[model samples]
Target chain A: MTEIPTTRRLDGHSALITGAGVGMGRSHALALAEAGAAIVVQDIVAETAEETAGLVRERGAKAHVMVCDISDVAAVNAGVEAARADLGPIDILVNNAGISGGMAKFDDIDEAYFDRVVAIHLKGTFFAAKAVLPDMRAKGWGRIVNVSSIDGMVGCPSSAHYCAAKAGVLGLAKAWAKEFAPWGITVNAVAPGYIDTPMMDGLLDDAGKAAHVAARIPLGRMGVAADLTAAIAFLVSEEAGFITGQTISPNGGEVIVGF
Target chain B: MTENSTNQPANSRFDGQVALITGSGKGMGRSHAETLAARGARIVVQDVDRAAAEETADSLRAAGGDPILAIADVSDVGAFAEAIRAVEAAAGRIDILVNNAGIAGGSPAMEEIDEANYDRMFDVHVKGAFFATKAVLPGMKARGGGKIVNIASVAAMGAVGSRAHYCAAKGAVLAMTKSWALEFAPWKINVNCVSPGWVMTPMVHAVTTAEWRKTHIDAEIPLGRYAEPWEVSALVAFLCSAEADFITGQTVSPNGGQVIVGI
Candidate 1:
């Protein structure tokens, strides 16, 4: 005799995901598509970006391709404007684009490499969010999810630049959450653990996966793309209206930090 | 790590799941029960008072939800655990637990605060939530996964005069939620906290006058009003949903931008 909710579909919403060509980004694109959101798949690579867009279109949702380097302010602004013209106002943004550079000690890493890492992870998120804020502010409703890493929550060994940029990204989201709450905008972050995505292709062989799963992860296996996407789908959905400025880590219980 | 419990259909977040919520006689707890019931969860409405609990059950029946009433005071650890066992015996298993039972105090000053009020605050808010969680953990661990959402207050992040005991108690809830998240992560149990700001509840209504409520609701809160109970219930429902599987050790505040603090 339970009365289920009438509907929880995102029939009228338009979303844009950065680096949606593959891995977690592509998975998120598909998940949102299933929920009935028109999608703008943004990736620097045109070929893969179009692939994700095609998948979105297959689900019967409108799909647009936005190809641009998110770190560059002018390029991101222009790209978003074009996407809005093709699709609609860019209200939902998922800053899922990031580069995990090779391991480098504090002294071994040079300034340019660090700056580049920061540019992609930290600056890329900042500029992309800046580009979409206009539509959200005007409409008085927006949802933004900054894709961080487990290393961001608990500093990992090596990759200092990646960790710093990822951690700083959360700071930016929290600042925006407080500043933009009046506009009905909610900004949050998702820090995934050792997820089995295209980014981890090199280390995801059967042997490596088994050894790592037994030694560290409490959940006994590496996470898949859907694990991260489920959280993102929830954050951007209307059901998550009250939550903001917080980070949810889907790391197979690898890193645990709380207040 | 467990990849969450697969994504559910758009219509039902619970559907066939059993949810046991404490302090469901009235206010936020009752609202949470109604929300989950509407979304297809079998609710175990736990409250100490039979009359109040039955009223909630009647409301649920009116809404087409058949809710089971479990009468037990959460402050009594032994009785509460037995009640939880009774629920497990009847409902197969409990998939979600919402610790929403708490008391209030509008005291004159800290100097006038009595030992009885201080102890009662800790007994209900802190111990009640803690032991109830303890009772459910064995079943949850054996079953491999579950969701636990503890209710906290925005006062934990800010100062409230003469309510230091309440704040301290709620603060402990937030702190232990982190530990539970870490401790129970391996079992696929996600423990999180929802620290609400001001909300339109019977508790708030009984304590404040119209002018006072208006002054705070209009001038203080950034959203220009206190949250409706359903708004708070929406968040609790989300955390219990499979979509929040990877989200452990996280504390979300639904305070209408009244208090914003970074983790």
Candidate 2:
């Protein structure tokens, strides 16, 4: 058997991950740290951010913690600046913070709920990307990976707000990829399907619901955070410079959506 | 132009792997072959032109790679199957298959397209990929897992003038890619599509003049330039590696933001 060799592909780089306290965000932070990048673990919960920072430290990489709500533009900008002050210029940014929002029919969705979901997933992605662009533009290199959902690509019933916001993330990523390509920045999106995370627990009523969702996946299982982390790692690597404005769906063959 | 930067260390993700790239004689297919071979894959260069296939294999051998030439027109199912068998027998196993053989027809209006042009387009792009996958599936299943990458175009998603046949064929390729991805998931085989915009290849050059390309095609692209063959190959190499083990049924387009802006 040929073993896949692991290397410090992101050595000397700095990364800031939103929602890094748990789930896919935490996984990305650790993976980036393992690849030799200093990490800025940002989340709404201070304790979880610190925990993620400690995990990064365990991997022998420097880490900083930031506790702020991603949906707030001012807070995101401030957090990004603070992260840069502590860890130097951020070379990578993962917009992984998002909320599933309430499941309701399109007509039943309230204005507040729709706005909140859009604020966190779509607007938050825009704000974070905007905050990091100056540093990346100055350095002439950067990588941004937005976390969209398979629901965004193929509409899901009772999740109109969530799906719309996720779809907006894809558009934001592509627009930024084009606008920033001259500065050597690459923007991409990762659409994960039915990941086994705390978020999944919140969405599913029980183990049976989770199993039912898993059964629908052609790969015969729900994706783990590591599955998405691997794709993000590849997209943010030095060799992946040419791949920009693309959406890589690591959905276990659940949906074959094209962009 | 050099396909890869010399400063970067060679990725050995495909070490001890065998890759069979259709239409490997020139352009993007050649780039795919070179990139994979450089990454430690033994090359099975398949093309309709025997001389071109030999040329690609010879270059691989010169670069300290083990390569074999297989001459078979991809549109011919029988010949293509034989070619696959020969490669599998020679290389011991086929670890990767790139369904990249394609032809571009003159951009005649859709109404003006005859049966011959339409059939040829579908035969080479759609049927070729279908039969190639059919031939490689059993071995991949027996061996536990493998990778298959089909080359598609941005036209599949949107319209392109005078190339309706080409667009339709690529769309079929995308559809088939998804179907195979679903069917092969249990066997652990990953299937994906690479939809490139206007890449700077000899075939592209043969089709359009530099002046027209600059004023029309290049202007529409946000990156303000067409992709180098290596740029397309880089994504294919990534898709074929262990890094993309979780990726399947995805159409990753490296089009300089052409299709994204709906151009």
RMSD of 1: 3.8
Best by DockQ: 1
Q: Candidate 2, which CAPRI tier? A: acceptable
DockQ of candidate 2 (2 decimals)? 0.33
RMSD, one per candidate, in order:
3.8, 4.1
Interface RMSD of 2: 6.8
Task: Provide the lowest-lDDT 10-residue window in model 1 chain B.
Answer: B1-10
Spell out the clash pairs found in candidate 2: none
TM-score of chain B of 1: 0.93
User: Per-residue lDDT for A49-124 in model 1, tens only?
Assistant: 9999999999999999999887888998898889899988878999999876565677777999898889988988
lDDT per residue (tens digit) for residues A1-259 in model 2:
1111223268889998999999899999998998889999989999989999999999999999989998898998898888899999997999999887556789988888888898989888888889988989999889999999888888788789999998899888888888888788888888988788898787677776657655777777777888888788878886556567888998888887654
Can you write out model 2's per-residue Cα lDDT over B1-263, one digit (the tens) per residue? 33332323333358889998999987778889988876788988999998888888878887778888889999899988998898888889998999999987867897888999999999999999999889888899999899999999888876787689998999999898888898998988999988888788777778788898889654677666787777678788878887677778888888776777321
Best by the TM-score measure: 1
